[model samples]
Target chain A: MKTRKADPKGVMTGAHYLDGDFALAEGALAAGCRFFAGYPITPSTETAERFSERIPFVGGMFIQMEDEIASIAALIGASWSGKKVMTVTSGPGFSLMMENIGLAAMQEVPLVIANVQRGGPSTGLPTLTGQQDMMQARWGSHGDYRIIALSPDSPQECFDLTIQAFNLAELYRVPVFIMTDECVGHMHEKVVIPPADEIDLVERKWYEGPKDAYRPYKPDTDLVPFMIKTGDGYRFHTTGLTHDERGYPVINAEVQDWCVRHLIDKIDKNAEKIIKLEEEQVDGAEVVVLSYGITSRVAIKAVQDARRQGIKVGTIRLLTVWPFPEKRVQELAGKVKAMVMPEINMGQVVKELERSVAGRTKVVSVPHCGGGVHDPDVILKAIKEAVK
Target chain B: MSPEAKNPIENFLRMDRIPHIWCSGCGIGTVVSSFADALEKSRLDLDKVAIVSGIGCTGRVAGYVKLDSFHTTHGRAIPFATGLKLGNPELKVVVFSGDGDIFGIGGNHFIHACRRNMDLVVICVNNFNYAMTGGQVAPTSPEKANLSTAPYGNFEYPFNVPYLAEACGATYVARWTVLHMRQVTTSILEALNHKGLSLIEVITPCVTLYARRNRLGDGLNLLKYYYENSEVRHGADTRTLDIRFQEKITCGKFIDVEKPTFLDCMNTHLTKTLGEKFRPYGV
Candidate 1:
């Protein structure tokens, strides 16, 4: 991977106190996100507001679209135009965006969506925290496809992981989500943005081969097709249908199998490189607490509390949530007595942990129905029960 | 495959993917022919032109066109074209879709894009019903028109789309029936030449479902009706342009006025506010 410095025009190279939402906007600018189209929803609206206020100064464009569907659709068009694009939304808006997210997946369009999650099954809570959309983020779109999602537990991580989100989106050519909740999105913390040369970004790979041989859906060895910007004279065609290597729609079981499998396998096969998990005292521990986003930060306090009571409790904080870290979870399932997971939702990510554990170990879910974060004692009790 | 003589317009089509899903005697193919002719007459660089469509019979235009085309999700062609135009200012983006896709499922985007006056040429093929999904009642389905979803007869008032376009601030607005071949093609060419948001609503025949369900005759009979009952009213009042079954169809350019587009307004505002500090968007 060839790495270069961030453009000085976009990088705010200094340490400053900022909220997670603003930090995410800054992260996008630093990572070369020059276009953002979005609808303003609570907790996520700040990100859009920041982009609108700041993008023009940096030679970028920000469009407040009609709704989340159009926002994502606009992002796809911008992506094909050789721009790193993104959108920010909460639950209801996210729900509206689900159809186009499928389109982005089908077309393998690289973009970022900062889902600053608020409480919802349907407008459940607008200003409060919830991780209810984790499962929806993984499988919200109606189809078989794979996407990359990252969880940032703090304001600093929101800035850092958004950059990672853009890089992973480019590398995998899929929509990468920054899955933060109201707690993380609103929390203010000191974030140090490094110098321009210190930041590494993945540039969109341009197709340099023969124009006649260019096939929009044909994958390279790495399973990602190179992109050609619009007006590049290639004049290729793309659609949200089961297509052949030429990007022409081919509706049949044979082509469907070939096309859908590539969309899944591209990320599945690269899961090892794509998944990132942070472990603390997991080795030789009797109980491991697996968590992500704001719940992971809450789980740390519970882990420390459990240790004081002489329980051998460890922590595994998930940074990348979608490719699920199956290998590591499978390895840990055999070693640990049990695993306890706490999420702001009613057992979303914990279900993935259970799948990876596959009955090898007991998996306990600490479910919260949103509107607020979990109390440390709730997770502490779950950890204690898991070890027993 | 032997070298055989082909139509000259085949250059604009993905001939390999021909035998399109449009039904026999459908007017969508005629509209496509008119669009191709418009492109040929416009004399613009074909490489810099893009076609975007939402899901419908009309949406298939993107797949058939040999440009940088995108068959996006339903009702999203306007916003998608908005992005393409703003992202690469050099590209001329056009959105083509059916009335159901544009005004029914995608109505909000249509209004918002018009309100923004986004620089796009949007061609809506209004067949009065959702033809692709089996003839169901749509926003433009005339009152008392029978459809699958409204078998008892539609009670809701259908939209006068040309009025809606003008009300939402479209810089150029026109209406034409498929029978008006030369006028339809000329309107498309004029829309392509205009700089801001231009909309052309084409009344086409959905003979298979729409006509058969409503007891109307075949495609030719509908074309005959259009030829006999239509009135050419240049710059007519858009509010009176609604179509009723077997009624006089008022068709012409309803609104054609110059106004600053979304990009122009945005760039002008930024340059004035930020002065030299504002780096203008993609040229």
Candidate 2:
């Protein structure tokens, strides 16, 4: 009961507050969520259940929907109704959600979804943590579009950055993924809940008046249109087709090109702000470790340990993974003599690092694919081997 | 909003897209007549409504309506209608889908939406076969029903529409044959006002697709079959039809429980609780 913090009504946040679970769920709710509908799936089930219970208490709607498709469908429905909605699941549920995720993008529905990384091509390890959906998150559905994804490394990050994921999703009118591994999802730690007034919540930019005049798809100044919920006065018409400025479905080539290009440019031009990464002690360092999420956490510990052993080793950790920070990789790869990448998957992100850092430095992948996360020692070995 | 207007059908329909697509002797035309009659009589504001249709002969319902509409992918009208209703919460959202589209491939989505009792109208035109796909055997196709897939006879048991709907927790469920025009139309109007998952299954005949294969005659004879054999029981057991499960029961209002739907419960909870802890995180 040492860390049991109680609200005015006095039900201690499950694990009873100021703990791992509370930090994760509370972080999302505090970020201005009004709806959540998700089915229970392994590893990520608690996330959905936790939110469903908490949302009713806090005025948000959390629905334990029928299946993964309906779960995400309900999430999309809630989001269109002007709620910062989200759904959480691991492998199988994530796979079922892919088609609707494409629907979300084609229709430009803003949502916050978290795939707490699990071991899988198809239900490989449900209870265990692995970073296999990294590639799938990018190219899972059958279509053409880009995704904005983030990976939080710790329980504290699970709190602080889940809010960031929500803000980014609303800002872009795109589904923002809060990619967390089991290491981060389950690990117990303290997360300071910043005071209520301090946190900034971004509701979708809304139009002022009228049912007839609103073109649901086209926002005048910003490429991302101002979203008006159905109850609101604006009579918005949006579809999953290549729509014109009016948001009515159109199949003409010119409109199709404009819609696709602008949807991408809205992310690309803002890549600098969106693609966040940590450059750790790369100043005059030869060997660098390319990492992200749990692998980055391991690489950070390994980098520190390697430095103690006098191996001029530094690490590059990616916070935002979607618009893969190739420029940073290119810059670091040229300066460093060699880079070692120890990932949970069978070398997905390393190929990108290699593509960017080609011929500049030897890009080596220390990839492992089992159940649990790649340990710090495994990466420490890669660091030592790279520096050797 | 005049109930006795000239051509009540044209008031609800888009006359610009005239000459409907159902084959000349098809019963879908009769169902559409009932739907239009319902819409006109209900007097729902056209500007604030959306008609969502899936890919089928019935999918064309969206294009024929002047209201905001969508002709979406195959067998997804319910989920799409769910999206529109949840998104707007105020719009009079409706789903227009056919037998094969709703009960065959889209069965999972249909069952789930009913269980959720999402606030929307589901207008199911059960022609008993895939009319658009050249009359293949559907999930709701009559037992011993003939189709391209079942040349001899359908071995599988057909799903009774109201049974499946009521069992899946639909707030309001009703059934009527197309020839029972006034009953079917009134059911559609009532469903629109019900404020939850309400299904009005219209038993139509595919004169071009199903009739040629089953030798069930055209829409006129199909209407005769419905008129002659149908037992108008409000609580008939469709699965265990009285005569050894052979009778195709013309059931109605099977389940009309007033359970709190997803939207009703959602709004009530949100309006009460969203104030106490409406704070931002990581500020």
Candidate 3:
């Protein structure tokens, strides 16, 4: 696609050993995120700290708001003012941001929110890794809407995928989620950030015609509308209510149906273009191990061990979790005997896999309730049992 | 003459959105009138001005205004306005909502915004209850005041808004009843020109809810009560400004001083710390 040089001031073009949190901050700068508003929480605090330190030098603003609700609210405001923005928080803080997150969805404000997942169901484990919020990330806010969520497995992918998250957010005009865990957030690895010219970035499409003719909610061929930047002499009205194409509230069933369907179908209809996954050795395998986030890395070891034990086990690692690559799962289900899933929660994403497979094949879940990653031996036993 | 020809303020409002939801004799309309007068007199670029509001009876102000308005979620207008101002330092952001919105559910945001002195003009309409949701008791509900939730009369102590604003660090704090239209409009004009966080508490009569429940006749009777019992004490100490059940309501400018705003503090600190390497935000 189209590629251009990044702003030299924001690009830190080199290689360094860094944690996923730090890499995420660098990725934001390279992606032209000019404003960051966040509230500090464990594991996710480092990302905010890095933004506070680095954003000022790049001619950007970093504000530490009163709480997570204010943090996301500020990001939505900044995004409307024609700036790329983001916020970072963990479980409890993510819970607090739900209402404003729904506001962002209703207004179709483009922004990024990174959730460095820790154990939960009410702050279960703060300092430990957990994948308990996967389902929450998909349907955290009330109402019917769809969002793109990405999972990163390493510090390097944390850097690469965060840039992708911003691009997807701008492309669809929806809030994109970076669903990582405490393990990946704190783990240090070598991350190579390429030269500014090498990284591809997406700029928001601004309305250029007569300001009088601008319709804020009118979608283009791609189902994403052009944005009218605030204070550009194009004064307009917008709210968190069901609105018409002019962005004025229209309280009726027809308006509500039109609004909700666009919010949902934009991503649902374009699932193939938006979904991202990485597959290995599943062409003719009898069993496949499906996993994401930190569990995918651990599942690698389990799959190799199962292969050594004469079991034909394959692997599928989710890069984009939501818009769940269901069709691919449906096709793979017809050939494979069974699919095994191991995650940090009590089977959150495996539910989606089961829905896609729909009894065409056996679906097995190896559930863990936070605190730590699954032991490879535990997953290996599940993989062996699935083939039986 | 046509209806639009009769009202000179029609140009500043969304005329099609008229027939507003406010009840008869409710003083919120007068407050809106004063605000419109202030906006007209200021002569500032209306295109660059943005009004934000949270959910409540007063929250509908944004929908009625002709500026770049945002009707955000409940209790979130301040932070959202802070973003708009900082995102483009040229935008004059105003937050207008009811007392239950600004001080009850959104009290934390109000306190923090004042503490930072984020550049914004916050107009809090103190109707003393959550009138939109059928008159529930609020943080500003007078002690022993009658409300839906507090049917036995509210016994909880109410907030002294001026004192709270002063303690939290607002650069300008003022209170005026709806009867003092010219004075309240003048206060708003001053706040619009001020640089940092400025809060103007307008005590309005909620005719259908607060007034009817408390045995006040109508909006006119409550206005007469304010005219007779409310004492205009300019520069009064905010600590003694609490409104007891029918006691003399002390009103006027309480805190007016100069201090750097949140952006000023950020830019100054960063320029000194980073020197030539620093680039001021909103450039």
Candidate 4:
């Protein structure tokens, strides 16, 4: 995929103090997102508020949809109509969006969704922070498909990874998630926004072939297909139902097999290029603390404490949570004595970690129910236990 | 028939995808034919027109149409169409789906889309019961009608679709039966040109399930019933448009008035407030 500079009109260059949610909105604008349809949900509403305030000046559109379900549905429509679209919500809204998220995936619409995490099972803790939705972001929607999810632990990453999320969504033609928790979403920090020319963006791949020969689902050299806008005279049809390359519904098992495989392979085959991790001092370490989102920040503190006690602890922060980084985890499993994961949920991504480790090393999960982040001492104890 | 002798509407349909999944004697095909005829008469840029459908028998309409059609999740076509129109105000977005899909599961979207006056033409095929799901009782199924779920007889009051559309602020509201083919086509064309949330409810027969369960015979019998019992009242008060079991079916245009669409209101408001800073979206 080729890269382009951000539209200068949407970029606000310079350093400023902003929260994670507001920074996310700025990042989306910098990445050329022209349409945002969102509903109000705590911890995430600030993103929508910021977007509504700025998008009009940028020659873009913002709609506060009736609900989260309608919000996601609108994003899919706007995306097909030749716009980079997005929406933000918390757990309750995220649940309402699951059905349409699947539709967006099946239709191969490029979209960015920011789920500012909160404690949840059912409206569990709307105002407080929790990373419980980590797994839900990966598998909340039904089906055998893959999506790219990025976890931002601070306001700076909230600004940076969100632009990356839009780029990946355009490059792969799939829904990309900015999975940040309430701590980061509400945490105020200094964020540096580069000039429009300095910020790179991936443009949506548009089909430029003869209108008669255009097929909405025909894959390019890459497994991803090129898109055409609704008013482009292509007269193409696309549906959520399993379809053929022509974008017409084909219900037979053969077409279903092809459709499902294409959706999965586009990301699975390119997982290495899609997944990003930030590691420190992992070489020959006896224990590694593996975490993502806000939990990773807390876990790093524990890692530093362990290292001071001569525990030889290293830290691996997951920047991209989905597409699991299985190969890297498997390789590290053989060498490390154990890996300690502390997340807000009881045990979510830790299961994926254990699966990748395949029992090669001890895996300990420091689980917190919700409403708050984990204390560094608790994670430190888990690391100590894993080493023992 | 040879390829040269294809139907006139073949230009607007995916001929290869036919024969469609719609059952024999189903009136959905007749509605589709009317829609195609309307498209032809409107002479709007086919490329600039998009169709969106929710999941159901009518949802399949998107698949058969040779346009930028979207068969989205159940009960989401309205909001989806809203996005399409706002994304590119130059495009004419249409929502075509069944009564169950529109009024049952997707009632909230319908009301809100109408409330917002989203610029889209909505063609709702009201086949009393949930025909696609094996004749289950629907929000549109009249009281005392037999259905799969309401085997003893449906006791639920059916929605007066035109009334609901009017109450929710739809700019154009009309109703017609499949038997009134030319009228359906005329209303569709008018709605297409109308620049707000326009709704045309086409009462059609679900012969395979709805008719069989209600003992209403097949498509022809229903058409005969419509011919004998239907009344054309163009300006009837929408509040009196409730459909009753085996009763006179009221049909005609009940509401048609001009109002700024969602985009129109948005653009005007933003342009006024922001002055030179705002570039009117999709102008």
Runs in model 2 lying further than 4 Å from the true structure: A1-21, A208-211, A219-221, A233-236, A250-259, A358-360, B1-33, B45-92, B112-119, B131-135, B144-153, B212-283
Q: Write the per-residue lDDT of candidate 2 for residues B35-82, one digit (tens) a residue.
A: 778888888776677777777888777766656666665666676567
lDDT of the candidates, in the order given: 0.91, 0.74, 0.90, 0.92
TM-score of 2: 0.84
Instruction: Please identify model 1 stretches exceeding 4 Å from their true place.
Output: B1-4
Task: Give a tens-digit lDDT track for model 4, residues A54-170.
Answer: 998898899999999999999999999889998999999999999999999999999999999898889889999888887778888888888899999999999999899999999
> For model 4, what is the alpha-carbon lDDT of residue B130?
81
Q: For residues B121-198, write the lDDT of model 4, one tens digit per residue.
A: 999999898887799999999999999999999998899999999999999999998989999999999999998999
TM-score, model 1 to reference: 0.98
Model 1, B215-257: lDDT tens digits are 8898989867776788989999888888886688899898999
The per-residue C-alpha lDDT of model 3 at residue A222 equals 82
Better of 2 and 3 by lDDT: 3
Native-to-model Cα distance after best TM-score fit, residue A249 in candidate 1, in Å: 1.4
Compare the candidates by TM-score and give the number of the best one.
Answer: 4
DockQ-superior candidate, 1 or 4:
4
Stretches of candidate 4 exceeding 4 Å from the true structure: B1-3
TM-score of chain A of each: 0.99, 0.91, 0.98, 0.99
Minimal lDDT window, size 10, model 2 chain A: A1-10
Ranking by lDDT: 4, 1, 3, 2
TM-score of each: 0.98, 0.84, 0.98, 0.99
lDDT of 3 by residue, B74-168 (tens): 99999898888888888999999999989988899999999999999999999899999999999999999999999999999999999999999
